[model samples]
Target chain A: MKKEHVKIANREALIGVGLVIFNFVWWFAFAYGLGSKDPQEYTYVFGLPAWFFYSCVVGFIIMAVLVTIVVKKFFVAIPFDEEVEE
Target chain B: MNWESLIPLILFIIIIFCVGIWSGGYLKKSTSFAQDYFLGGRSLGGFVLAMTMTATYGSASSFIGGPGTAYNQGLGWVLLAMSQVATGYFVLMILGKKFAVVTRRYNALTMVDFLKQRYQSKWVVILSAVSIIIFLFSAMAAQWIGGARLIESLIGIEYTTALFIFAVSVLIYVTVGGFRAVALTDAIQGSVMFVGTLILLIAVIIAGGGIPNIIADLTAENPNLITPFGADGSLTPTYVSSFWILVGVGVVALPQIAIRAMSYKSSQSMHRAIIIGTIVVGVIMLNMHLIGVFARPILPGIEVGDRVMPLIALEVMPNWLAGIVLAAPMAAIMSTVDSLLLLVSSTIVKDVYLNYVKPTASDQRVKRLSITITAILGVIVFIMALNPPDLIIWLNLFAFGGLEAAFIWPIVLGLYWSKGNKYGALGSMVAGVGLYILSDSFFPQPFGLHSVVMPIVVSFFVYIAASLATQKKTV
Candidate 1:
């Protein structure tokens, strides 16, 4: 049981680090990869330029979907303890 | 003056006051005033928790200043602002179970309470409180100015009278209802923000002759307006990317937002909030900023970006509807002000005065002190806000950077890493805050990144190095 507890703890930490890295990569790509451009040179999409479309609209949609999936999948719900009688 | 517009705004304020008064009844009957006043007895459900987090985090900057900046910077600023979509998710997810469990075990009332317990160091508590009071004064003042500005623009009143009205309204409700009042009203205000942003965004797009014509006008005027690069080409890759740190994951360190993570009643509520809060924040942020960018074509050449939200709403919609729409920004401002006011008051009364000065004070004394301190802090912030800045977003962001730098590692590492000790937390805060202020003053955007990035990086290293160096032998 004690070893299992440590394994869960290690898994939680691993997941935490994984999410952090994912977030970093997400922003890094948006900011550095697609972001390093002159808007005058880029193609526009739906009144928004490609960079704007991909980064803000697409990025927001992806984040919303990703967050929902991750929460439902990885976050195990721990029931709250019943209120202690004073 | 648009009297029609003012009527809906007046009605909105009246509704807010009613909510405040309604919550005050709860304040009266709560068994422990401290828990009820500060954390709302940790009874916030999923939706309320989601809205309170959204409302508190979405300040005047997100509503007024953000749209204003987007108007100027075009789509790039909108892209930058989207970084905040993950804010509520990050806070609730990263700190969700652990924060709630530990803070409950410790019976912690404030963020400072958690820190003091985690570090087991007096210096950590004092530093945390001082950092909160100092930085949040600017943050609170920024919100006060925002509320005052929106009122001034709406009713055709002078700034001081508007400030007075905004200050008094917030003080009355927050002092009367405390955290429960703020949390409940935040639910109402968050909904306002969501609906209002949608209405105004649709209206702005229609007013701009639809998306196609708006795009044509924008391209004809300045091609960069539709692109990721800002109008001035100043929203550089480095600057925009680094901003994610200031507003995104770093949000977990913000005491106002972080406290919400601990206040929810159940893990199911946390899970629900994680979804709802992210969706609400994403929609509101995207629509509001898009309105700002889209408004540029409809209401061309507005000088003050802060006035973009009000000016565009009035320009696009009818006076009555515009009044209702403008209420969203007002709601945003009031919700932010009330929360910040309560947070600083809790810092002083619960963290400092109660901990150091009178640890044994009776519940009655503590309640009186908390209310009085909240009122006084409101007045002090009012005085500070009289001379309003040109753009309140900068003030708000400055405060955000300072707080995030100081508290991020201490809070995050302290939670995850058992080896983290008082020496590390103290060193982290001192180094983080001191370096942040210095960089912001002198070497802003060091290496082309936001001023906050450097301090956060430096503090992280300092925290780890100091912790390892000072680790005492465990018997």
Candidate 2:
């Protein structure tokens, strides 16, 4: 039971880390990859035309809130069951 | 003082005082003095919870210093500052039900109480107390300086005298009513923050003519100002990416923010706070920073960054409205200082004095010590503020970095990992502090990464390895 709980938590933690990494990379790709403007030219993504460190915060905030909901609702306790071992 | 300009500020003070008196009544009548004073008797509703969280988190940095940096750095700093929009959501989400449930179970008034009960070690209690007292004092001193400077600029008073008056005002309200006053005033101030940012942004746009005109002016002034790398290209990719660790993820460790996570009454309140707080923080941060850049075209040359907001407001709006609008930052600084002062005082009064000095101290004595220490802390911080820096943004950031470096691993790892025992917490803290200071003094950014990166990495290994090794020994 404890192992299951740890598994779920570890999964969530990894997903959390992954999302931010993805967003940062998306920003770099959008700014410099296909959308690579010259150093002198202004960088813009769509109408915004920016490297998305700040706007990506909106995505992060939503993810954080959703994680809290998931932790509160779906992430149920399995309780400690230590007697039966692998 | 100009009566016209001072009227809104006067009204703000009067309203805050009334709330303090009312909350003081509630506090006096409560069964648990510490609970009432420290955590609002754990009865805060969703709206109050959301507002208080927003106000507490939005410090002088958010309102004044952040925008000031934005003014100089142009829109890039805005991009960077918005990374903090997730702060409120992160706090509520990360330290939600577990922290609240565990804190209540432990009857913890402060973060140290939670740590003490969790670790059952006197060392954890002592170190947490010392860190809170030392680092929070520096943070509090920065807010005090910001407040004094704001008042000085607004009312045309000498900075020292203004500091004295502002010091007395905050100390008196907080000392008398404690967390209740802070929370209630936070609601008022938080609304002011949202409205003030809105009004100021609109006024700035009009002052600059419009976004297109503002862009043209900015391009004419310096084209690089609009880019991601900042004017001098100091904001490198590595440095910008590393800041995510500082202001974004690692903010979870700040005691001031961490304690907020433990304050609300219910999970529903926490959930509501997450939603409401994100929207508000996003609006405030985006608009304030945009105003910083927008103000550049409007008010061409301002030497000091801190004065940007005050000068912009006065330049565009009426002096009277400027004072009232400017009260938002004042509110932000005061709310932050009040919370930090109380947190530090509790670190001394509850964590140290009650735990070690006299475990059997009566309620009256605890209350007395809390108030006295808070006042003393306020006075000390005021003295520290007399010689203010030109831009307080750096001072505030240093304090932020110091606190995050000092507390992040111990608090976060302590919560999740069961193997995280006392030795691990100690070693992690030592590693974090040691590396942080070393990097701070010698090379703030090693290989273009921020100073905090190396320390955090070192601390993580110290925490995990030390905990694993210590666990075997204990077994």
Candidate 3:
């Protein structure tokens, strides 16, 4: 039982790190990859530059949704009262 | 000063004081005064837990200094600041269940308590306490200055008088109510920040004649303002990416935020907090920084970046509505100040005084000391804030980097890696902090990365080497 609990926590932490990396890759790519273009050549989405529109605005919604799903599906509710034996 | 705007702020302060006093009543009837006062008896629920973490993490830096910097740097800064969206998620998720179980098993009140029990080293406790006090002092001073600056601009009061008022208000409630007061006030403050950010964003966009017009003005002035490289192209891709470590992953080591991980009522609250916190932080950070970038077209050439948030709000909205919206930054500053004040006080009283000074001290004595220490720390920070930096964000970020450097590896590796011993923890902190200061002062942005990255990287190896070298000694 104890080993299983530790495994669950480790798995969740990995998922958390995975989400962070995924968010960073998305943010960096859109921010720099597309944003590296000249200003005169930029496209607008809702008044924000295309890069920002994708990186920050769209990225935020994606992260919020992804995080909600991850928490609901991947995270297991663990008891806080009992002291885990070392 | 417009009296209409000041009324809402005054009303907000009054409500916070009432909450503080109400929570103080609980302090006296608690079975475990230390636990109740320091950790809020670990009874935090979902919404309160999420809000408190959000409020505490979203300090004057995020509300005032962040917008100020974003206003200067333009949209690039906003992209960099968005790294914070995952802050609450990382803290709650990585440290969520295991941290709560272990700390509860150890009956640890502060982060230092956990370090002390886990490492069983006097140096570890002393170092943790010292680093928290040193780093959090600057962090607290940043909040105090932000508070005073907001009050000074809003009410048109003298800086000294504003500082005095801000300091007194925070000390009164924090000393009276403890963590419960801080957490409760944080819930209110966090909500204020969310609504304020949304309202101000829409107002700024409308005032700037919408997004297309604003982007046009920005391009006319400097095309780089709308780019990812900042107004002057100083925000390099390398530097921006490193911030993912500074504000993103490394935040788990912040004592003020980490303590919240152990104080929640159950796993359900942690899970709930993770979702709620991620969404709130995303919305608030994205909107607040966007407001900073958007305000550029409306209010151009503001010399002080911190003044942008208040100046733009007053310019775009009616005086009454401006006052109410401005309370959001005020709430952010106060919530952060109260939490830091409590954290430093706990480090001094619970970690240092109780552990080393007098282990046999009575509950009443500890309680009195905690209150007294909290007030004293507030006064000291007020003194530090009097000579404010032109941009308080650097000071706040400097504190963040230093604390993360010192605590990140020890806290994370200690939990996961069984081979992590006292030598490793101690070695990591010393190397991390030492290298961080050296890099920050002499060789900032070495290799085009933030100074924090090197120290954190170097210390991770140092932790493993030191731990492996000393394995036989422990056995």
Candidate 4:
């Protein structure tokens, strides 16, 4: 039998699902929630509506740094013999 | 008088032709004619594999059409297109080591080769061959038209004559040296694309007087230009989200790309590729689209969107520099055209001719047929390109959508889903492709989702249902 799928009931799974939901909410908020106003007119930085933009910048940096670290540590552990043998 | 502008283009072409010559020499070294011509002896390395994948996928659409659309749509298209940053990542992540090992084991030269081994069915092979030939013709024609249009813009040549020149140059080099020629040259073209995007984006931004100035100018022109909903609020949220499937994860299914997943030397290479490819793709996509929107303030009253990038580059950069910078899109167009030429040729030679016509054809005959077919396909695409589409990107994307719908479930499920058999595979492809065409025609953008969404769903069900009902031995 194929390996059983690990239950996606962890924090990472929740966060991933949450972020996707947030993406939809944010989009809907802009499309319908903001009453069709120009989004650039209000790039909130904190409690401000544009604060999300700053979050994206931060989120990108964080994701990049995290992925880099994970790759450096985790992916390197892949056995070299396993690579060529397969 | 303007030799500076022409100098870079001339130099670029010379370097590319020399690389083609070098690859041709390497092609001569291979003992078997078919092995050398089509698959490069199945021995591409880390850097070449990554570069080939990037250049083949980047295409004129990424540099030219993508940015043009971004220019028209504003920030939302940027968000949607950036999802494509994960393209190489997904292909490497999903199909990585296993795909390479299996194909090498099976001696599978083309995507159709994989299906042939898996199903051992001629119908699967024929269906795949038909889909690839038909859709790839549309895709190749789009690239040919883009190449001609770029040349036309630069030298003030008529589109038809420019197209004829472009076709001959690409066909000569690609036919002479097959995949190796294509891969080696892709490394060169990919670098050109990377640097070209940076320079042109910078020039367009500076010409627009910087980001804040551009934003202010956009607001003055129409506040909606700064919004995600497009100039007329037509880019619905659902429309934007569905693109995640079209250009993002769904790209894992594109044959041109999936073939590369199996072409690399090592998993280390795949790991390396994921990082380098993601960064390069991210930079190209973000900068190119931003340049498109950024061009708005500098070049007002631009009626034709596709011409926006070249016109803005010429306007902002000096003649010589603009010539060098403009080569980015030119590289994109040429790289895409060459890869498509080789792919369609292989589909004919390896997939159709060898499998059905002569399972034991001589290696010499195979080489000749492959070369002749590559040239013929190039000529046919040139004819299709003569009357260019209003926006070549749509044609390219339509081809993308259709191919993804046709192959994604079959490839993915075939690999992972043990229950997936030949019957299920055939059912899923037929259902997916049929609905994909039907939806695109009769009910485009159904329920605000992309035309591809429903077909993927329907095919997923078809695969499961057909497999369960058949209950043939699987995996």
Candidate 5:
């Protein structure tokens, strides 16, 4: 009974939330999982600590690209001027 | 005093003033004065929509306080701050087309207007207006103090003088031009922030003799500095992850931000904004915090955290270039201030005044009242900022938490849940705000999570329970 645009928005919102959870899981895993190790035992990637490089640096790039793809693929553009059915 | 450094900032202010004056012309030509002045007549394009959201959200904290914390906490704070990467995406997508179509159908100009029409309750509108006024006053005061302090230090002038100058610049543009002025200036300011952070990061890395040497220096100083647990091991994974609520998902509730969802021209603009806003927020946030962590070796033993950004910029870059680069923070502060000012003004003029004070007030009267209220609000905030509290960052954060707790459930559940009614909104807001204050004060950071988390969680249940309990009566 809901409008098509609202249904699309609801689906897109679920994807958005999924992406957020994915981002947090990705961040938390690399950050706390790899990062909890001792500093002397740490590795480096591109001059950043291995944990930070993976968690923040790589996390940022992956999220950006993933978001772009998700929006382009899954998200549909609905008209703003359409009337809402009460 | 370095005259070279002052030129770019002064020029920046001059250009902002010109934009304000230019946009004011549209205010005159518009058919609906309130819509044009408050929401820009829904004419925003994709790029401007993205930039305005970025610039408005990137306040003094992101530009100044964030880096300073990064300096103190090390790489962990950078990880913590990255929780904000999905802010614009969450706001635009979750609200998305439904919010825009519904608001247009209701003829809602402000977030409170949407709430008012949706709930059909006088109390909901009043509570929303009051919460916005109270919380945003503190937020605006924080911005005012930050702007003054930035100008005071950069130009080597007295704090009072800097405050006066800063107050005048913001008041004139916002009072004259309204939301269009805020959005256009935000576009300019957002660009400045992007380019400025990029330049400063590269310069800081170079000054530190490359990233490898900087990491080495940090390791030699304290191995903990390179870890994800912060310098003192206080940034627990639990606490850091909880920020996903405070800065990440809960941001959709902020009136200054939520209103952006209603202002874009089309779904194409919204689509474009989600992509652009996500990337820009990522780039600026990562670069700024990284610069903070990287600056520690170059300028060792800085006492205050807020001073880290300006001091590092001056140290790593030439004065003239530093001046230009430093405009990013200034841009951040002003953009936030103008948006908050206009928002608070509209809350009073559109929501409170028109609804209660005089429903039949003429358009001319309403327009005049909005401009006057904006200017008056600026002056009041300026005065409050004159004797600044020592913990301005905490003040800003408190405002964020308070606003989020008060409105998050009501706005979000109200939009999606058909069973959500006025009683449910009232219960959720009262419980959320009351519990947030009690927890923030008496039991600070229960279970190693930020204070905002519990209230938001509990409020969700309160909203559902209250709504279901009252469903039959309303029906």
Candidate 6:
């Protein structure tokens, strides 16, 4: 039982770390890749340029959705009163 | 001064006071004053937890200073600022249910309490408490200044008078009702921020003659303004990307934020908060920053960037409605200030004083000390705010970077890595804080990245190395 809990803890920790890395990469890629375009090569979308629209507006919505999905699906809901494995 | 606009603001203040008094009733009936005062007795529901966290995290910096910077930096700043969308998710998701369970097991009231119990070291607790006092005091002062500035611009009052009013209002609610009051008020304030930002953004867009006209006006003024490089093209790719660490992932180390991770009632609340908080933060940050950029076309040549939100609201909307909308920034500032005030006081009263100064002090004495410390801290921050900076965002960001560097590895690794001992915690903190301060002062934007990036990276290696070196000594 103890070993099983440890395995579960490790899995959760890995998921947490993985989520952090994925969120970081998502923002970095959107900011650097899409947000670094020159003004001369811009296309406007709903008054915002394509880069700003894609990287910030779309990126923000996508992130909110993605983060919500990850949290609800993978995160195990342990009762706070129970013994927490370190 | 527009007395009409002031009416809405006055009404908002009255509502906040009422909420404080209501929460004070709960405080009075609690069996444990310390826990109830500091942690709301760890009974925060899903929505309340989400709102309080979002409200506390979104401060005058996000509402006032952030939008102001966005106005100056153009759409690129908005893109950069959006990195904060995942702040709530990251904090709750990373810490999760284990933090809640462990903190309850330890009966830890403050983040320093956690550090003391986890590391079993006197120095670690002292350092954590000291860092919270030092960095959070600066952050609190920035919030005070931001609150005062918003009031000053809204009503055309003298800066000193506005500062005094702002300080007194926050001190009364925070000192009287404590964390329950802060959390309760934050729920209201967070809602105000959400609705207020959306209303103001739509008003700005409409006033500027739609989005197309606003973009054309910006492009006409400066073609670069419509691009991703900022108004003057100063927002480089590297600088923008590095902010993901400073404001994004690195936020897990912040005590004010991390403490919330453990305050919820259950894993269900945490999960609920992750979804609600992320959506609220995303909406508020995106709309608030966009309003900053959109304000440019309607109100050109505004000198102080911090005044953009209030100034734009007044220009585009009716006086009373503008006042109502401006409450968003006020709410953001007050929620942040109240939490910081309580956190610092708890550090003094519960962590430092109770632990070292007077371990056997009576509960009444601790309560009085907590209230008195919060009031004194408020006054000190008020005095500090009298001599304000041109932009309070940098001061706020400085505090964020310092706290993140000091506590990130210590708290995160200490929880997960069994081998992480007191020595590793101390070393990580010292290296994180020391290198962060040194780089911020002399080597800002090192290699075109924000100064915070280097310290966080260096501290990670130090933590691993120091832990490995000290493992045998511990056993």
State which candidate has the highest DockQ.
Answer: 3
State which docking tier applies to candidate 6.
medium
lDDT of 6 by residue, B1-475 (tens): 8999899898999899989988888877778889989999998999999999999889724632599888888887887888787686777767776677668888898899999999999999988888888778878887787788888878999989999888888889898999989998999999999999999999999999999899889988998777667888898878987877877888888888888887888778878988899899989999999999999989998888888898999999998999999999899989998999999999999999999998998778777888888888888888779985544445566688889999999888887788998988899899998999899989899999999999999998898899899888999
For B1-475, candidate 3 gives per-residue lDDT tens digits of 7899999989999999999989999998987888999899999999999999989888723632599999999999999999998796888888879999889889999999999998999999999998898778778887788789889988999999999999988999999999999999999999999999999999999999988999999999999999999989998899988988888888899899889998999889888999999999988898889999999989999999878999999999999999889999899889998999999999999999999999999988888888888888887788778886644446466688889999998999998898999999999999999999889989999999989999999999999999999999998
Model 5 ranges off by over 4 Å: A83-86, B60-64, B388-397
Q: Rate the local accuracy (lDDT) of all candidates.
A: 0.83, 0.74, 0.89, 0.73, 0.89, 0.84
Off by over 4 Å in 1: A1-41, A80-86, B60-64, B387-397, B473-475
The stretch of ten residues in a row with the least summed lDDT in candidate 2 chain B is B388-397
DockQ of candidate 3? 0.81
**How well is each residue in A1-86 modelled by candidate 2, as lDDT tens digits?**
25565565455445445544654555445433422344345544432345443244345455456645554665433322124447
Error of 5 at A26 (Å): 0.7
Model 6 lDDT tens row, A27-78? 6665566556666667778777777777777777777777777776776766
Model 5: lDDT of residue B81:
88
DockQ of the two-chain complex in candidate 6? 0.57
TM-score per model over all chains: 0.93, 0.89, 0.97, 0.89, 0.97, 0.95
Better structure of 2 and 3 per lDDT: 3
Candidate 6 vs. true structure, TM-score: 0.95
| Docking quality level of the chain pair in candidate 5 | medium
Q: Write the per-residue lDDT of candidate 1 for residues A1-86, one digit (tens) a residue.
A: 13343344345445545665665566557545654665456666686666666666777677778778877887776644435556
The collision pairs in model 5 are none
| Model 4 regions more than 4 Å off | A1-41, A44-67, A76-86, B60-64, B387-397, B473-475
Between 1 and 2, whose lDDT is larger? 1
* lDDT over C-alpha atoms for residue B165 of model 2: 84
